[model samples]
Target: MSTAIAATSEIRFVLDHVAQIGHLAQSERFAAASDDVIEAIIEGAATFATEVWAPLNHAGDTVGAKWTEQGVVLPDRYPEAYRAYVEGGWGTIGVPEEHGGQGLPFTLQTAVLELLGTANPGFALCPTLTVGAIEALVHHGTPEQQAKFLPQLATGAWTGTMNLTEPQAGSDVGALRAQAVPRGDGTWSIKGTKIFISFGDHDLADNIVHLVLARTPDAPAGTRGISLFLVPKFRLDKEGHLGAFNDVKVVSIEHKLGLHASPTCVLSFGDNDDCVGELIGPEHGGMRAMFTMMNNARLNVGLQGVQIGEAATRKAVTYALERVQSARSGATDRKPVRIADHPDVRRMLMRMAAQTQAARALVYYAAAQVDRTTLGDAAARERLEILTPLAKAHATDLGNEIASIGVQVHGGMGYVEETGAAQYFRDARITPIYEGTNGIQAADLVGRKLGMGNGSAFASLIADMRETSQTAALTELIDVCDETGRRLAGADADDRLAASYPFLTMLSVAVCGWLMEAQGRAASDDDLWQAKKATTAFYLNQIVPEALGLAAAARASSAELYAVDPALLLA
Candidate 1:
């Protein structure tokens, strides 16, 4: 199996040209992130990812994590790799300085995450969830909570998890039955069974903070009554030192298709009626507080899709260049040639490369918007609200598609587990399902995001996409957006629901086209620019046209969809 390599040059190019990391550095919030410092950080992270993390991917996948009477145990190399990750300050790159971090821009941190995720996503999840946890605490934690948890979490000494799902309530979070009762001592007793908790328990960190969602006795029904709580694996005494167990038990770790190194555990809280938790934010405000972490998590999840696609594309490209096959059809001499020379193979490779590049541009652009929000740009923040779901759903869908194409590029070798192509496919499958399924994302786009601030957010986005360039691709995108916006405006609730997924797809494809055009315009006469231009052409000519079909689908009414009986579906 070929090892996955980070495309440092491509990443640097996107960070500079598309995301405009320099402009972000000029912001008062990011004044410390000079260009040289950013470059050095990216380069250093790339080296660590390629050397320390990539080597453990295969071992982690094969050996997997283990569960025993003691607890969940990761593969041997993971501890050393995680230690190096913390020592290198990779986990603290984007955290605030007040929390014992270097305080770099989130855009730069996102780029670093791309490197780590591409190298090894299983290992990357620990830090990813921790960052989300830290963000939640920063926004909602009390001064005392911040004093006790923020520094350790920001420095990567303690990891975190978001506990939302239950056996009965997977996507329907309102259906959760986890119970929390006031202990009358500035804490609450929480009891529930949470499932599909990633990085729930690991030996790599001293403590694990779980942001749990549960209901109080007198709270209202459904989501509104739910509240967010901070539950640590180990209890802290008055002096803020780790003491006894907190009654958070890891029942078992899942045996999964991919990302075997990442332990997905079913956690049982308060099984012995001794679990204690502290409320975060306001009472009965779990949804709002959790969204703070979930929104950021959704964006990172989208980047995961981009990361896997990039890794798979690299593997496929390498394989095509080395594998020999029949000569070109027109050749008089009967000599073999690299499969990369075949026209069909070239098509497949181009699709993988182009789609991966476009997705990278979208993810980075979204991350930049996040950075802009920190700089106090209200418009940028609004734009992020619209871009979030599109980035998450579109990138993940492309990740799965591109990985399947990657397997096809490798032929029979891709089918066998040893070649590692199948692993990419397996790992990518979870992105769309978790982090709010793509279906939910699409619905959010059409139902909620489109209507934010009387539709000003999406309207401004379309206007910006139109103003970005005058290319034919952008023109097609503009038309699609205009039409979808029109359909959504007059759409009945049911009709809009039916068209939501296709509308999100069209919008995502159009955004990718706009970003590609931007890349082409920014290119110099160098070889990298030349390659960018060619990929842009391929994306515009081949991929952008899907928007027309999706737009048509988005225009379809719900009448036909609902005309079919529910009994027929079961039949």
Candidate 2:
């Protein structure tokens, strides 16, 4: 089966059984997202992703995007494929109706994006960043700003980039030195170097709207003084037509391990003092505005995990079923058989399928909560706040793990670049690093999200998991998660920080386990869902028990960690 086709089958099952998307349709805001409409959308997007996008993945990876003085040039058919994506209205699927979009639920968008990302992640990154830009502009941009940029971004006529990282400052937003000075004509003069800007320069769109984080003159130090600016590559005239260059230059692009088609550019603004920008949020409110984009982005990035995992798993399964090897143990004839006949090979394939499906369930569940909160569900908002970090950190960690497993299942051929298994591994490597590294995600979970709503958010999560859990091991995992969370609250800073990762994994596995059981129980006796049921059993039975060990690691002494001096760890 086509990878996108298989993914659609899995996602459809999740929507029907686990994601609670039907409940979302009950809301008047999402009432138009009828069952038939959603099904059509998924089927159409699958076709588009596989036909228009999938064929380009290998070429995009091999030829990649080339950096030119004028702009970044994508591989063959990249522009036409992107144009087809926009014309198909894929970008407008989840945008609000007021912004010239179709106004579907974001969960649907997430599902569709997963398909596209699976087909060709390097190309899909362009539209993904555009979605985040539309989100930021919708929430934080002024009425004038919205009227000016939202239409273009919502429709993908103009792509967008988030420019926050500088060479000197990585994760510490407080230390950024980029500056935006008021030009006394309603526009600001933005001057600074932003490194690692995805799609910073590309020929895919008419313009690139950069959401830049910078300091304004006379503003306070650190993040308090920071502000967000909407700087475009090309300026518009009085008639709102494309005009001058605006001095937004792509100084250089990175030579990365993967995602070669996605231009990770080092951009220079105001090189000749001609870059004009408009403030996004209030003065010194860059972090707030950026977080509005990022919180949404974190969940979207979570889908990347599903994307790569699904792609890798599908490829690995196909190879396993086709490649012939020695017969199973104790076979009388010892005839050659498909590697899939081996018990250990089957075990690896099962784990990959189960974990990928589980991650999909968890992220889609979070996406459904986002839809609910849009319709004024207060509790859903609290749940979304907690689910964001879990989805971002956990699903991405699985992406890496599953991709690595995909390689191992391929055995020797996996090591060769031609087999393409290695590319997924290289691409999956960045998901956990970017969009707030998994480490930061873990810290957010322990320090902020766990305590949200006066601890009610996490408590409510555990309570809900118990309500849905179908197996004892899952219940036990949830219980351990609860215990670990409580202990960390009373522990020292070092211990709490040290325990963050394991607690994150434990909680993530519990959430996935609970959702898996729910899916399993609700599945039909049909061929497709029968496999879901089997995978769910594997998750609840075998994988869920791994959390028991992780729980102990969660309580490991910070003293043992600090026992090694920082100096010894340095290169």
Candidate 3:
């Protein structure tokens, strides 16, 4: 079968089942948009991703981007593709209609973003950052700020960047030394160097708006003292047009392992006196404002995992079908068979499909939950927050595995640069690292999500899983779900409440399996349902066993990792 047909079949089956579970609407964010509109939006995104974006994948990896005195320059095709993105109304998918956006639900936007990331992640970074900036302005900026900036950002006239990282302040915001001094004219002057700022300086948009995090004098220690500011590349004139040079300068861009199309820049703000910035929210409430964007960004990052895995899996299938190899045992004919006929190859493909599908289920469910929280009853919002970290951490980790498996299935060809599988592998390497590392995500799961409201969130999750299991037709499936749910529910406070990193992988597999079973039953196509069933079987039979070991380790020690020192790990 053709790859498109196969993808359509699989996706149709998955969505058909997923739709049966409940209203899988994108989010309350798009409560105003009709179902037809939403469907159109999704179809458009899929076409663009598979056609427009997919073709550029190798080009981006091969040619990458170049930096010069003017700014970061992308491939020639990038401008036209980006223009298509904006002209198609993609840049404003989820923003409010009042701000020149389509005002779709965040869930639908999540899907669209996934497609964009999958098609060409390097190209997607600029828009992603822009959307986050628009969100921040909408939530916290003064009315003038929103009215002035949101429209341009929505229209793709301006792009956005977040300057939160420094050489020393990557994971720990407390270590930030960037400064925002009061100018007494209401605007502040920001001075600091930001590293690894994606799209920090790019020529794709007319102007770049940076949402910078900096410390003010007399502010308290650590993250609490930080403030957020809007620093633009050029000052705006009375007519609200771009004018005059801003002090922000792109010192250099990183030569990274992957994502060559997107420039990760080292930006120096206020190196000259011209860098004027407007404060966002309260002076000391920058972290809070940043969170408003980070929450959405984190979920978006989770979807990237799903997108990358989906792309890699699709590529693997194409390679497996096209390449003929040795026959399986007992084949009487001398003709070679497709490598897919081999048990190991079949096993690998099955594993990749299952993991990708499971990760999709988890993240999509999270997306639906996020949307429901906005438009549905109060309980859903609480549920979504609880599951958000799970989606981000679990999906990304699975993405890493899927990418690795994709390379493995390609064998030696996957390791070489020519196969294009290596690009997916290299691109996927960063998803788990950004939007908070998987380690941080797990810690969030254990430290915050599990114990919130005296275990009410996780308690609700367990109860819901049990309810689903009770209704399940297959006793074995129900037994697996029930047992895992019970273990989750009955654990002591320490077990439930301790550090979440080590235990996150196990928790994810069980929950993912539970969700997949729900998805399988809800499916409409027999073949798709069968596939879902097989995937669930794999999860239960193979993946869930790892949970027991993880749980055991999690319960055993807080410092077991230290038992083997750095010296021993060196080999």
* lDDT comparing candidate 2 with the true structure: 0.89
Q: Write the per-residue lDDT of candidate 3 for residues 458-569, one digit (tens) a residue.
A: 7787667666652222334334433443454456545544535656766666667777777666655666467767877776667656555664555554355557878988
RMSD for each of the candidates: 1.4, 1.3, 3.3
Give the RMSD in angstroms, all C-alphas superposed, for model 3.
Answer: 3.3
- Give model 2 RMSD, 1 decimal: 1.3
C-alpha lDDT (0 to 100) for residue 87 of candidate 3: 80
What TM-score does model 2 achieve against the real structure? Answer: 0.98
Ranked candidates (TM-score, high to low): 2, 1, 3
lDDT of each: 0.90, 0.89, 0.76
lDDT of 2 at 54: 93
lDDT digits (tens) for residues 341-460 of candidate 2: 999999999999998998899899999888888888899999999889899999999999999999999999999989999989998989998989999999988898877877899999
Error of 3 at 464 (Å): 1.0
**Residue clash pairs of candidate 1:** none
Find the number of clashing residue pairs for candidate 2: 0
What pairs collide in candidate 2? none
